[model samples]
Target: MTQIEENLFSEFWDKLNGATGKGFGKTVSIDQDIEFYQELKYNNGVFAAFKVHRMQNDMAARLLDENGELKSFKQWLNDVQTIADHQVEQWFRTEYDTAVERAHLAAEWRQFEREAGVLPNLEWIESTSVTPGKDHKIFWGVIRPIMDGFWNRHKPGDRWGCKCGLRATDKKPTPVSDLPAGESDEPAAGLDNNPAADGKLFSDSHPYFTDHYGSKKNILLESDKLMTKYSREEVRKHFQKELKGKSLMLQASQGLAKTISVSHQDIKTITGKPHKYNYMKNTCCYWLPQLLKKAEYMGWSPDMKGTAVPGHGDVKNWHYYRFPLNNEDSFLVVKERMNGEFRIHAIQDKEHFKENKLKNPFEKR
Candidate 1:
């Protein structure tokens, strides 16, 4: 696989596994869950695209080289499409099952927390389907603190196809100790007993925990969707033909929409004060340019009908638009000045906007 393919697969795996971890820690957010589902769909699309590229190359080779009686191009195309479809379907099913399992585990953890009033200690429960490994047998009855890094690495269902589970207990956990004269301190050969230099108790290389924690440096950003579909040269040429001088501005705006770089001025304008949820600011930044792009593409003029400014009379030249972001309605209010420049006057959800009765800023009368 190419570097991009490998990175995509790695990201898909991490997001699938990390769902449970985030749930256990109560750090899961709607934004994270939405991104998780989006990444899964994106990865499947990438795989399908790659398959098409490979099929095209293979068809060319078969036509040129004398191999066993070559099939018709039509036949070859159908076979390739069938295989690609199957692969994509299988990928979706596998990932979807894993995501469901992780979500269930997270829900269980939440319920456990609500009833137990503390992180529940886990008791490793070995399955009876297969002969238990020596390490599994040793840890079978052992109870471990939920807060320890060991659970992060060695939680039940850590391995692929693992049928093991953990039973929650409110009692104190059994401490790790030497079994006999020659027994090793570690539970298994590859699993490490010490934390890494980064203060992570789990090894970065551990298969179960490797993808659980780390920055996603290789995952493609959403703004890259347009660039990925069309090359930079192609996009630039198209823009030159259509937008002329504004092409650069469009390109820069689209690029900025993918990142979490919100301006302090925009944040203050939207929230009146610093808001606790940074995700809201980031979401606004991402969608603002997207909304503009959609309007331009659809050739829809901005809606500038002003609403009553609560105590103040109706203000003119204020534009309003609403779009769904993270499964919520994001209402944006902007003002077009005399110079034709647009300024983001305010942004909030539909409910919040209605509740606050916010309006356009004005000079003291």
Candidate 2:
């Protein structure tokens, strides 16, 4: 018999077992040559011989391949592992995009409901992620397009569909503060009766906006439905863009009567004194670029022009004309008092904006 026939017959005998029943002295033999080989007639029940044989060969091939090292099986296993990793990464990407899209859609739906004055049964399910909370709250006005895109293109179980079912639960209860002494855990005995809980409850209730909130600080005023109704430029003009910087001085009195008082008399004594020679007395602030250019104008040397300011050679290559003036530089001319309004432009100290306190533009000698 051939190798294929031998493999087939081997599987056939393994399946045949326990022949003591109704067939009185009857016996069955394995057949391999017949192409129409259907069932193996046993004393008990019939079995599909060809099908079982084929399955045996396939299983044998798999086991042998798996047992061998650096074979086709190893290669196939590696490929399968790679595919599984790729699938997991793809799932994470899809989930992340969906989370962002959901936030945008929720914001848009809320806007629509507010505008129409019709309360819809649709409540938003937020993704259980902390990273997007701040972003979700901001730019809420411009998120309608993103929401519409997801809503129209996504179907159930699609990449953008909400499948994770991950939602935020449990909010902290407002604590009671300034509560009066009582037998039971009750509110304050004050006239208002509602004790402020840990001061945080009132803090949360108070209107809080981010550093850039309601401001065109870095935002460009664009024409939109909301912008048209409530002009962006008009609203942003009043927004407080200034940051609260470190206080050089301290307040003397407590609540209501509080006023800033200079405690460090030594600091005032050292910094308040006027310069003796007054190098800036006759200098014009407009000619600052000319003074700066003494170091170099792109590549021109000081010998080709006037005397270069010492130690300013490093800044010569710097494109100050294209660059915004340092706010500290405002102090340089501060020494050279200008007769005009003395208005400080916001752009002068774009990066150095620390509190409202002015930085000395002129480097101290």
Candidate 3:
């Protein structure tokens, strides 16, 4: 590796180690939280380099091996030098894309806070590139409702290798005809202009912009350790407080509900299910209350009725309630016992729900 590469490797190593609470070379004190973020950024950079450089996964794994001690700077240098010039360019492009997105989101978040309640709409002001294409020109100075389909769907820097950025503006955007004409005849470099064969526009090709733009604020806030550490009950209570008196319909429930409740045991049961999807476990903690809330609104009408739990013999009074949670349907199996106590036999996602369908006593009938 050259001098610059050597320095960069050393810096990354130091930051990574320091973030893990192990100082390198000299003891450099840093706030643990700050170090955590720095460590993530450095790790992302390394992984991006590995991916863009097309380094084999096994080689990357070996470099990170910590059986004995951290690898030396020379060892890292040897590994990095394997990356070719084109790979380095790809790595830079990835980094540039991420940096631009983060900066834009940060600025937008700040402006959102500053202009709260003052600006109901925002416009995307694309940076005037020398060779603006039809795709770029169409989006230039276009005003749209913030958080609506058009704005959410066509945020700047959505396309692969796109360098164009957007500035949020409150003032009405100037008409396209009134805007200055493009200076160059060619389209923007590295941009794909051809629409999808189905006639989907270039903007529609990328969906991340629509899914993530509106959630940027919540995403950043949730990244903090404190926010992530909230217990399931706490999260449920918070949402309940927020949704109180609001007419919210659960897609699965198909009706407006007043309140929802999930016991701590319910959370435990769902999360502790063996062979459950990893996401089902994670989302159960956060989405359980929401699902229950929707369930309450839906009035507990089971799509499929009269199920029985296996191994416990036939029970005719059992009912199943299915609701959507985090893009997947989850089911709550409940049986009313002779003593009048409601017993929850199982709480499962759509996958498990399907697997256990035969166990349902009503399925046979």
Candidate 4:
């Protein structure tokens, strides 16, 4: 990843899992017509960006060698294509599905809010959540008139993972004067409109775009398609032509003792973020080269049994290494391809290491 992706947007690269999915659910996938209609599915299974970089910058950075030389295109492409065969499927069916589902659900409810606009009053109903936001509960049962601008902004689903909604009621409207302090006065950033009023399935303020790439968020989202576009030979040509780098040794880790190939899919295993494996962010990419140079070897283990990869051979053996990230106690496991090179197996946390008795690096495996 480039310094811009690695540092300026490290949050998108380093810790995207924890706080993403905001501003997302306000719009459910729906098409506008003479009458509003929806089928409850994503706009497309793939999130395509009409404007995209096509792996010119951030991806090109990954091709650079230890000496700051760019690796031959053939080398970088082989590295990218060697990544896990089925990682994209797991993410789309799970994470992307959840995001679109939330957006659909929220948009569905907003339709109710818009239809109820003719009613004199719509009451705010704040529901429970495992992860709650600042003030949804404070306005619980708040009945404001339909014409109040407050109704146009600030609904329950306005916040990420929020379960708030507006209820239709003809009861006496709560006076604006009754709000305590500054409560319910301003809509949160990016959530200033009703999705039902606007015909988009997502609010423009979605953090998937705002917090990460701003207007260019779609570049990252369209990646699942990017991963399946090339073969090892083809992609190497891509890297060679695109990067115009020098020849590559059999292994990029010449002076280093051991090397592990970190693929785009392997990244999601570390952060649990839903992006497809087309590129790497430097935040986690640093671990790989570092592991090759200075990490303690933790030996091999039987590859976890799972569904067979459809078109790829399964690795029966796996290798592990322990390295320090800031202060995190973690292990990087590499999978062996029967006829190919070594690729990452998993990036597990301290608790996972403890459960398997791999926490102490000096402890014999």
Report lDDT (CA) for all predictions: 0.41, 0.24, 0.40, 0.44
Cα lDDT for residue 221, model 1?
Answer: 34
The estimated TM-scores of all candidates read 0.38, 0.18, 0.38, 0.37
Where model 3 places Cα greater than 4 Å from the true spot, the runs are 1-77, 80-121, 125-141, 144-154, 159-268, 272-281, 296-319, 326-328, 334-347, 351-365
| Higher-ranked by TM-score: 1 or 2 | 1
**What clash pairs does model 2 have?**
175-197, 176-197, 177-196, 177-197, 245-355, 328-361, 329-361, 331-361, 332-362
lDDT rank order: 4, 1, 3, 2
* Model 3 lDDT per residue over 194-272, tens place: 2111111222213222333234334333222221232233444554566564423222233222232334444445444
Query: Model 4 — TM-score against the truth?
Result: 0.37
Query: Which 10-residue window in model 1 sums to the lowest lDDT?
Result: 250-259
Candidate with maximal lDDT: 4
Which lDDT tens digits does candidate 4 get at residues 108-153? 4555456664666778766656665666677788887766766555
Error of 1 at 19 (Å): 12
Q: TM-score rank, highest first?
A: 3, 1, 4, 2
Off by over 4 Å in 2: 1-104, 110-352, 358-365
Runs of candidate 1 with Cα error greater than 4 angstroms are 1-86, 89-93, 110-116, 128-138, 178-219, 222-365
What residue pairs clash in candidate 3, if any at all? 257-297
Instruction: Write the residue-wise lDDT of candidate 1 on 1-365 in tens digits.
Output: 11234343444434444543443444434323333333323333333234333333333444432566677877666656754465346644543444444444545543454545565676667755375445445556667766666554454433333345566787777766532222332333212322211212222343322322122332223213422332223333443455444312222122112222223344344544222222343334433444544321101122344343441123334444554544455555554444454455565555554423333323121
Candidate 1 lDDT (Cα, 0 to 1): 0.41
